[model samples]
Target: MQVNTRSDVGGKAEAMDYTKEAIADPVVERSFRGHKGMVTTAAFSPSMKQLASGAKDGVVMVWNFRPQLRAFRYANSKSSSRSPAGKEAASPVHKVSFSPKGDIVASGGADKAIRLWVPNVVGDCSTLKAHTGAVRDVDFGDGGATLLSASDDKTVKLWDLKKQKFLQTFNGHVNWVRSAKFAPGGAYAASGGDDKTVLVWDMQQKKSVKALKHHTARVNTVAFFPSGNLLAAASDDKSINVWDLRTFELLQHYDVGSVVNEIDVHPTGDFIISAQDDATVKIWDAREGRLFYKLHGHEGKVQTAQFSPHGDFFTTGGGDGQVMVWETKFDRSIASIKKKMAMKEKKAGSNLEEAKPEEVDAKIEEETEAEVEAEVKADAKHEGVGERVQAKKVSISEPAEDAEREVEEAPSSITREPEVNENYTEAAKEEVRPKTAPSASPANPSSSLPSTSVSGEQVMSALGTIVNQMNSLMEVVGRFDMRLETLERRMDALEK
Candidate 1:
């Protein structure tokens, strides 16, 4: 079936599609909406049942990848039994991912924290806080047992999910680390950072394997094909280069004619998807080194694109706040051959019982400990957000109140005390009040409510209405007084 994809501005999300040419096919099956900010990145789970997206609003939302309505829950919102998935509103999440074997997910953000999430759960799976700057990317390693995070702090952190402690920091990147990933074999991991270099690290040795440096500008993304033999790096220099993983040698270089934001190899190893600032996503024949399809529709920069695990569909997220899923015309002829090749690559005479029950228990205990540590970090974050929000509100409403209170108390410099006060205030309220914006209703004497610090802005904006109502009440009172005096004079005359 031919799929048609088109984008239009200021229309309902469903109604925006129109064919650019009469002969073109519609490419989108359905689009889902949930994130309140620009979707920075998205990935399909290995099972293809779920879609995860990270946004600048600090939210990492997981959506059902069904062709019909894909329901999602916000992470920080109240739980509803009717929703297909629960919300764990971790906002401003720069990246989100699912483990290869389980429903667990890892999300990293500008907050310099990494959070792991499990499906049907209400909160984070585990929280790792080691980076001092924004975490640029995160991924699962060692069959989702280990978590790897890259950050602007110029280091990549390896977290032991079982031990619930930071394993080690891969510290060779001279600039901010942009992306990292475990090779499909799980023996080594690759990281690309702002130093215009890619470093491969061996897990057992816990050191750098090789540093691949060729791009003249910052490397934005790096990916290893499922084969783990080929590495592709996208960069700000408008090029995508293929390299041999073992030798770290550049094999093929292709100019994308724009800043390449992300690169992904198809699971079958035949096609490559490169998202670019040119507002188009290009599919290339990875082997032939030629462009196959140029998918153009996004009105803004295309941030990232990936093929579904099944290879039948692909999705793209852009700066326009759109996530689009497209069907492909490619057949399964390549994938079937690769599957046969994979079966042959298994090592001969390996012990099948290497994984034991005790080992599994140990991993669970470690992840549990990591989860506990994450809970403490989340609580601290909740407190920090509350304080910042309160301070912003107080400043916007009446900073003088705090200043006056401070002067009256003759306290030490407020320091971060505003945050402490926010905690106390929330504890006293002990009620989750539904957040409200200023009401749109007009002000009148009949409905006159005294202006509190919170209502000052609303009261000022509606001051004219309040004044008119007060004038009307004064006029009524004036007539009542005159009528009372006249009646008293008439009674006195009658008495005489």
Candidate 2:
């Protein structure tokens, strides 16, 4: 379909150099199955209320995009009648196009005939015949007063629809012409063919203007960007190429990795869809030249894809003989923009000043340290309370003599501290270590002590145990901090 229009030739622009966002997940809204053979081509009406599809069975079907919007549909338009000589009357169809006003559905097929069907009413279709070879593609001009068709005749032809007469034929390709499109004002036309070339023609002059021969194989589809400044083509060479129309210079190349059968640019020039032989439909961001999503419902090679005129949805037909409709999900576009914005903010740029790296590191370190300290203090308080309750119970019930017994009962509690206290008690009993001890000046006048009075050395040793436990907590916090830093770095790298 033609991308450029009278107004909004200036469409949604994106920065091709920017970082790409994550691909979107696919969502199929509807599926229509009736064709007994490969569905070759499909197109959305300008109104988007109906969809027109043509298949190899020589049938054209018009379907309601939405169940609520009722319109006449031709579920099977192929004639079942056979000739007396036992020959099939119907010919394989290759392409279908909707008029600008959504009033007529035009289909071209192997019969070398273009049939115009009034899809909103039950009526006979009218045929317009001129080409001697099978028609491959057809499109309506700006005002729907004219039509363009590419065919196996090795030429692109323009016809006056209002007069129902052939206007002109531009010949250049030595092989079948596959696709044709009109520029913004319909003054110029572009066509791609099996000759591995894309040609731009001045329709008024009836001569070729630019010849793009970069494709290594048959060119399958071609389209002009909305502004008429760029044109894109897809080929069996497994690539899609964009050219600057003004300079006729190659601007971008996308290695699709599979034979591309058909490609269409969105009306806003923001997205493009490629139907590939891998049974996949690839959606790409036009400005960034990035593959945004891959749809995987068709069981056979996907042959045709086109966007709705409003750009909110698209439809695809495949060799499986089914057409699937999918919504683009505008919310995902906003999310992608937000993600790209975040990437820009994080990246170091001359125009965007960033905080000093050292300053950020120091700030994070300080916060982590504070949090660790608070957690350590809370653990110490809880530990002290449990210790005091255990000590009181031991003093009242079993006495200090059974402290070793209590330790044996709860082996999980206080393993090292009890052994240190035992060693100090043994030293006091021997009296050999008394000389290094402090003098007992506090017991000179008023002394209140039980039979077992703990020495000052034991208290110092217990305080050292608490310091050791705090160090262990700090090590645990350090490990956690390192892990968080690693995670943040990975996320930053992906965004860039």
lDDT of each: 0.67, 0.74
Off by over 4 Å in 1: 1-26, 66-70, 75-91, 121-125, 331-496
Show how many residue pairs clash in every candidate, following the order shown: 24, 0
Scored by TM-score, the top model is 2
Error in Å for residue 271 of model 2 = 2.0
By summed lDDT, the worst window of 10 consecutive residues in model 1 runs over 388-397
TM-score result, candidate 1: 0.59
Best candidate (score: lDDT):
2
Q: Report RMSD for candidate 2.
A: 15.2
The TM-score values for the models, in the order shown, are: 0.59, 0.62
- How far is 158's C-alpha from truth in model 1 (Å)? 1.1
Q: Can you write out model 2's per-residue Cα lDDT over 26-111, one digit (the tens) per residue?
A: 46778888788899999888887788888887778888867775545453344456757886656778899999998888888887
Which residue pairs overlap in candidate 2's backbone? Answer: none
